[model samples]
Target chain A: MIERALKTGGVPIASMLKRGEVKILVVEDDKFLREILVGKLEKEGYTVFEASNWNVAQKHIQGDRPHVILLDIVLPGIDGFEVLSTLKRNRETSAIPIIIISNLGSREDVDRALRLGAKSFMIKAHHTPQEIVDAVKKTLEEYYLRR
Target chain B: MKLRVHGTLFAKFFWTLTALGTIPMAISTLFLYATYESRIRHIVDEDVARELQLNSGIQFLLIFLFVLIMATFAAYIISRNISRPLFVLTEVMKRIAGGNLNIQIRVRRQDEIGDLGNFVNEMVRRVKEARERQEEISAVKSEFISVAAHQLRTPLSIEKWAYNLLLDGDVGKVTPKQRELLEKAVMANESMIRLVHNLLDAARIEEGKFGYTFQKMDFVPFLKKLLQDRTVLLREKKINLVVQHPLPRDLFLTADEERLSIAIGNIVDNAIRYTASGGLVEISVDTAPPWVTVAVRDTGIGITKEDKDRLFTKFYRGSNVMHIATEGTGLGLFLAKNIVIAHGGEIWFRSRETEGTTFFIKLPLEFSPKSPSVVSHDSFVGSI
Candidate 1:
């Protein structure tokens, strides 16, 4: 039934990506993690691109308009907080939902990210790669349906 | 008949001095009274009036001396009893202040001072009990860490080997269903390994009694194995490493193989963390006669001067590193320092903010069989 609804147009269940493509950008400094996120999201049929730092993420956004971003709080140069804020401030990327996937999930960080237009914030230890993919898909679909 | 200290020679002497001063005046008054009475009797009437006046003067002197003696004895007894116990109590207070709460002051009387001593004893008992409770709480926390470390690794061991088995596809090519589950398991297991590592470190640090087994090992083959084993893990970041040589083909170093590997591994892991994708983490080895050293340099965000000083201390996270990443238990560097020190080596780092960081470890080339085992002894004392 979920597959049927998703294949039709869009599912109200906010889980339409199980059988569909949902483009995603994974911004993280941890290479090991970037590979896993890219692999898992790609397997789940989401178009996935990688960025090791804020500079590459900015570059990626200029070309491809991803539906959702998996942002790591700690990055190479500019941290994820700055990246999230910049993305939210831009008109073109403002509607593009973000989910902070990071080792920093302190209440203050989560609250800050949420205020900066992140759809959700998740701690890496608290969620698996697959869960992150699931969350991104759900949040994107929810944002779409709400809009 | 009782040999009384209260009415002893000193008390009598003090009283005599008082008596001597007052009695002379009393005698003169009496003499004047007698003369006045005799003159009055001669001038006007009576033997009776003179006799009565004389009797009153004698009685007054006798009563005054008696009261003076009694009061002097009472004052002596009062000062002795009150001051002696109070002085002893103050001395006991000093000892208690010096952390010797073990002394018991014997208060023979059931007076206020005895009650005070008992109250002090109760206070000491309570303080000692509170200290014991704190020690017990700390012990429980350490025990929990150790127990949790051991327990966590068991599940990890099971899941790790199980995933390996499943990924090997002995049960046949995995369906998407099976793949998804195994992927989650793998992810969770990795996190679990990190948690266990942190818990073990915390427990060991708290216990100050880390169990370590030392054995002489070859450095060359160990380094080779490390480089080979971590290639895939490092490939995730696409980071490259350059190994520079001043090392022999197969250098023999007398040290605990496991501990040395862990220490080097921590440094390598930290380098990997700091080096961005496409950045370099360089490993170089050099010798200074009796010493051999390994240096790891990363092109990641570096440490400030103040941060560099406190880098290897327990729970110390550098400002630059902290901004880049979180979830560090901050025990790896501390453990690495301990391991290196145990091998009679020195560990230090050089870093500049935004430039990058380089950590160097120096170990003695020759290990004396009599390496004192000083660390273990110190650890034992600390545990106590």
Candidate 2:
């Protein structure tokens, strides 16, 4: 069903979000999952950045400003919750919309992530790679359209 | 745990009986004294009557002695009647607290003590049921390592995505051999998805999400069709699958066909799974008044005593047959047991090591007739 949504109406929205101008930072710990997400996001014409751990994620966020961030809760060094709080605390990254794509499916975790200023929460297991790409596209459109 | 006695049963019984015996005796003794006083007044002069009054004092003392003796006897009998059962009840309670749920105090009377015994029995049953529920939840939690949906599902999602990418030829044009290898990968990925899906269903079943859709239907045809489908497995193993009885002409039942099918299917699958090549499997149905019993007997490697004890426990693969067949997720029989139990039925098995095994499922003709919902369909992993 999500695939149908992406196929029917995703292209125009992808163009409208200015795929070339948009930058998305994916903060995930798993190497294989990172590659899959990167491949999907890059295919959608967005400038995608990757961070495998908390230190790299911190460095990347401080040096480069991305319009949106796809954050995962489980990480190698400092966990995703800490990363979420750090980014939300900073003035520059606080305005950037974060969509959590993690395997933490409990209601408590989802509520906590949303309360910590995430734009959306998607369970990694429930969605296809393309659907996640569509989420990024939709979040960007909503972010820009609001301004 | 300390047992709390609500009221003093022995004291209550002793006091009630003593009062019953003494009250009448006191009244009768007073009447005899009154009659004796009148007769003495008529028969004697004033001086003689005074002496007669002294004699009547002896009669009063004798009556008091008799009443005391009778009250003591009655109190002993009454207190014994209550105290014996109470002693037995206390012992039974101690046994229960020590984790023996099968003991029941013999109820012999229609008194309060009998009611207490019955109440204790009911309490033990409820405790046993609650313990079973707790066991299932903990088993499911441990099986998935606390995050069931996330653990298997994330890997399945990644595999499916990767397989889809390969099929789409996004990376490069695939050669013929590469396409064949990718197709195998797709098949393997699908099986992994199915396995994860089954695990999710088992978790849902543990979580008490049995979506049953009960309907009135003929059960004989359903059983026949189910067995007919199993012919493939039977032939592959060269096993003789026998139906012991002709389909009952009047076998109508009210059941959730899908869930019941899955439950029975799991048993039949086990029968096929454990049976050696060229073995025998028999299916039979018999009626014992209000219940219908379905038995699946297989002349295969039977369950060991240790395995039988843990058969219904979740994710419990038998230690004896671990090397025999290693593909099972150990959730099939657990799911079947719960499904049968939820349908107001009973499931058990009889087995002798190295001989054979027979599983029995008993279902009542009438059960909870509440309208069934379709929500449980999502709990199933593969196609029904």
Candidate 3:
């Protein structure tokens, strides 16, 4: 279920792309998971940006901002929900789809993140980095059609 | 009327009692019709001739008898008037007792009794409204808790896994105290997670907002399959589970597998916990008429008679069981009983003080699965 939801939600369309390039951002607190996500995301033929916490995530959003964020619900300072909510609220980052990649897989949790405008929610243990990339790619593809 | 002999709520032949009792009165009235003015004078003759004639008292007795009958009829009408609203109020009380907080005692009359009924109705309404609000807040609180729990889980998992990764020398070796601290942290995090899950589950169940999908599955094979799945854990405990399956290999019955899993899981786990080393846990099936029974008998620290009475009660930690096990929250049996009752089933048990105990669950083969009735629990959500 997690993999499927992620696969459907992963894709991020870099707005300034030459109708080809896809840019993805991976935001997490743990250095290990961050490394794992970036390695696989980079291998998937897209530029990937990494942030250890919400501060760095904000920096990435402001400068060298990617099209979509693979945001973990847990971060060092401000959490991922706040970041996702801020992104959705801000006109500049609002269009960039947010996928909540976290281990919190409870139905209520999923419902909450989705209600907070998260494109989708996925539990980490069930998904590989490739699936997240696929999720981003798929989400971007779907959003491009809407655009 | 005549006193009722049985358990019936309403009585028949009430009108006949009135008619039977009215017969002589009717005859006397007929007699008076034949001699109208003279009979009227004779009936009240004692009132006209009191202390002057003793026989005149007989006519007076008749007049008084007529008035007594009239008063009895009038009393009936009055009692009926009082009973209608009283019945309505009783029905409202029944609804409240049955957990239907939304029912109101609608009394429009301004009499003292009516006012009392109206007051009670309004009180119930306010209570229902307030309870609905409390329920709403609890739901929102559950939602927030669920969300917060999920959000917090990611970091906690990362922290725990990272600590595990650290302690296991995936990254580097750690000191014994450091490892111990991480272990404590992991344990605490686990407890917190469980607490959140239980609290949310309880709130959802209470609010009647939870969804369940039921299907038919066999009992013995189901346990067998679950045992196979938990073989590793069972092996660690070194305790054997003997299931005497006289039931059909594919005994079809209607239920929600997951909920039943949780229910039976609690029983099995309780047995596993309570049974000392080398002790056996016996799970058996009894297919009797009117019910099917699944029993778990364990050679555990047997429960006291007091413990037996409140075993399935929420937050009740048995004295002996508590001494043996401290890690449990005492909510599993509570949840199990709740789910079982909801499934139109009965869960009960028998216990011996120091020998052994057996818990039994008898579920209907088929039942009218309780459709979630419109309740304060529903409006509880709506208001929020």
Measured by lDDT, the strongest candidate is 2
Evaluated on chain B only, candidate 3 has a TM-score of 0.70
Q: What does candidate 1's lDDT look like per residue over B300-355, in tens digits?
A: 88888777678877778887677676656578898899888878899998887777
For every model in order, what is the iRMS? 9.8, 3.8, 4.7
Q: How high is the lDDT of residue B120 in model 3?
A: 73
Lowest lDDT sum, 10 consecutive residues, model 3 chain A, at A11-20
Model 2: per-residue Cα lDDT over A1-147, one tens digit each? 222334455334445446365678899888888998898888878888999987887777777777789998888766687778888988888988899988765555777899988898987766667778889988876765433
**What is the lDDT of every predicted structure here?**
0.73, 0.76, 0.70
Residue A69 alpha-carbon offset, candidate 3, angstroms? 11
Give DockQ for candidates 1 onward, in order: 0.02, 0.25, 0.14
* lDDT, model 3, position B231: 66
User: Tens digits of per-residue lDDT for model 2 on B202-222?
Assistant: 766655544666677788898
TM-score of 1: 0.43
TM-score of 3: 0.62
> Is candidate 1 or 3 superior in lDDT?
1
Error of 1 at B171 (Å): 6.0
Pick by DockQ: 2 or 3, better one: 2
How much TM-score does chain B earn in each model? 0.56, 0.59, 0.70
